[model samples]
Target: MKKKKIAICHYRVGGTDGVSLEIEKRKQILEKHGCEVKLIAGSRSKGADYAIDELEWDQGVVPIIKENGFVYFNRKDLEDDELKRKMNKISDRILNKLDEIQRIEKFDAVLIHNIFSFGSHLAAAKPFAKWVEKHKLPCIATHHDFYWERNEFDIVRNEYVRNYMKKFMPPKSKYIEHITINSLARRELKKRFNIDSYILPDIFNFNQKPWKKDSFNKDPLKELKIKSTDIIVLQATRVLPRKGVELAMDFTKTLQKKIDELKSKKLYNGKKINADPNVILLIAGYTEDMDHDYLLKIKAKAFDDKIHIKFISNVIKANRAYRQRIKIYSLWDIYVHADIVTFPSIWEGWGNQFIEAIFAKKPIVVFEYPVFKEDIKREGYNIISLGDELETLENGLHKAPQENIQKAVQKSIRWLIDKNLNKKLEENFAIGKKYHGYKILEDFLVKKLGL
Candidate 1:
């Protein structure tokens, strides 16, 4: 049998973002199923086979295109006509580069990630759709997020850009199939664009060797200057407004108030809680490009509350590797050190870190976001949920209700001290394996490709 060559395309690949991580996972599964997979991206990163600079969100003409099209229109700098021209120009460049890659690779199908649905790189849509049409390529458009879901892309600038978004953002064609990461997104796409899509939730490799303390990962705590006795609450999402990291700080602060009470109890690992233990929130995700202000706001709140929080994205990479002779840990490596994982995201297409915590067999404290409620909660995983409601504080940060926070804090302590902690974790891991393991994704791809 001839191997199916698949090209997985994204604006950025081989990075820590959910889409990039998903691409890697899908690539691995596809290759495992005897498909030759090639990674094509807008920016250069580890594991990218080809890069088209114009497709990048933050580089080349993309930012300018986004400013004129999605952001406030700058008529003085780039008029609507000029902006459209520039968009078309970049689109052609991308098309040409993609065509060149196709000529060499002769891919059987193209699996595109987020380029059509996200408003971040509008220029790539038309060219990508054109190339697929020209090649008669079977395309799987996987939408991680949509423009309407984001406030930043609310203003469409003009009718031309609006038309482009409508027509080519996800161009309707017989050769194309659409996929959404959750049921909500699937319904939303059908409701908005009348486009039907398959639901492919985030998945993990549950059968792989467990992430544990090794020589490479053993020093993350010491390197971060964190005490071994401190209770590490891991927040493993990128720094963004919707991530609701401030809620994690609030939870940690409330949990810190019970340090003395914890000191009297034995930890799940059969060790006593420290006499003066600190509940540290170790954030191990990079700050997104436009969310520096949000990061600052979170830092300010942490300072005011005196929450012991550390941002260690500098030491975390997409995979374990050495940079400049210094060992950088993967997200999984950090998960090995986590006593509890906090996934307090207000919004997510699908929860990657949540599944990761379950895979790592660590207790999770999660905000019951919409996707979790609609797609994941029904699976009956054991989790410390922050309830599905939120209250906005004066500073514009969202928080779970006071009672819910206290309840979650109490449950977290019990999980930390209870000798039966592995029972709950194992149950959660089993549920995750049943619903979201790699085999689930492999079967989906096998059917999608007709292989």
Candidate 2:
């Protein structure tokens, strides 16, 4: 096939958010398969064929989101004129940039990510969806999760904007090859609007060589006050109720008791258990809900229950930049140090944590969110499963060593474990590359857009 110029649009790609990481991986794979790419968003991109500044609405502050360590860029607070103006300015710039792209290059297609599926649609995403509705330009909306899944948005009008945010999209979206991250999302898309989408779970660059954690990652940990010897049990998901962060605490607590039991018996053959655990659960990242006072209260209560949890959102703000001003580090830094990852999300669009755990070659304990069953679970992911109650946990953990995961723990510890989701990782590797990778996208272009 001849080369094609593809421009991707969405929110910022600088951080370790699921969207950012997926787009980055997609770009690398697409480039390998021969496609010129560029970026457009409120955030600048070092990875682009041409970078355009659409608007900085997402870059501004929403008093509510700010208190919760989040920014509502495209979601203007509306009460503030300056913020509103900034948002308008960014939206206008995005349209203008689209016009410019059309004028300059072949601009074969614009792979829109998450823009039409959430309030974060700032740049070319919203209007792009509208434009694609008219088939103005060949495009696709690769949704990790949809806006309707969020509980807060019940009564919304702006049909264009609302449809853009939720899985309940208009018939026009169907013309654009709807792409989802998990099977649950695909089924929901079908059930709600009869729209079928391709599944593109979050992916990592498994083909490329990885670098060792160096001074940049080291500095963030130093400031985080995390000890090198401490086993890092990370809840590497967004701070939301569905994420089930307390489960991470509960598991750590369980492990603590086992550790203590092991110590008391002085047996290392998985025979004796320890009474006290030296494990640490790091609750990292910002919660979008500023009014999460209830969440705060609950978190405090969890702490009181002896779950050694650490909040490192501010420390790892956006990236591992040492501007000497902020103590930001990439989420990858934590993944690099994880002894185990806890992702007990009630729901996930595609699941970035699953991708991270596999690529980093670590163990993970996750809930069987319906998406797991629908999307990648069957491919092979032998993870420690957690039912609603704590009863199933012991059985899950007791077989940790024999439990076959995609990769083994590099640490010296060994025990019987479950090997349920190991193959899911490889499936993830191939599917992610196909669904989001350049090759699959090329097929989508021909089949759906007829480009």
TM-score versus the correct structure, for each prediction = 0.96, 0.70
* Predicted candidate 1 versus true structure: per-residue lDDT over 1-451, tens digit per residue: 9999999999888888898889989988888889999999866567789977787788777788888786544434678899899988998899999999999999999999898998888888988899899999999999999888887788888889999999987889998999999999999899988999999899999999988788778898898888888888999999988999988998999999988778757777665666788898999998977778888999999999999999999988888888899888899899887888899999999989899999999989989999999989999998998898998888778878889999999999888998999998899999999999998888888898977
lDDT, candidate 1, equals: 0.88
Candidate 2's C-alpha lDDT? 0.57
Model 1 weakest 10-residue run by lDDT: 69-78
Best by TM-score: 1
RMSD of each: 1.6, 7.8
- Model 2 stretches astray by more than 4 angstroms: 1-3, 44-94, 104-106, 119-126, 133-135, 157-175, 210-224, 262-277, 289-295, 313-330, 388-451
lDDT of 2 by residue, 1-451 (tens): 6787777776666555678777776666556657777776554554455555543333443232222211322353344444335444555666666676667875777777776566433223445655554435667678775756865444443333344334324234544666887767778778877677777566555555543577667554456775554556788876766676656666666665445333434222122323443667887766765427536854775667787678877766445665567656777777776666787776677677776766665566776667776766666654666643322232122122222221222121232222433354455455444443445544544565344
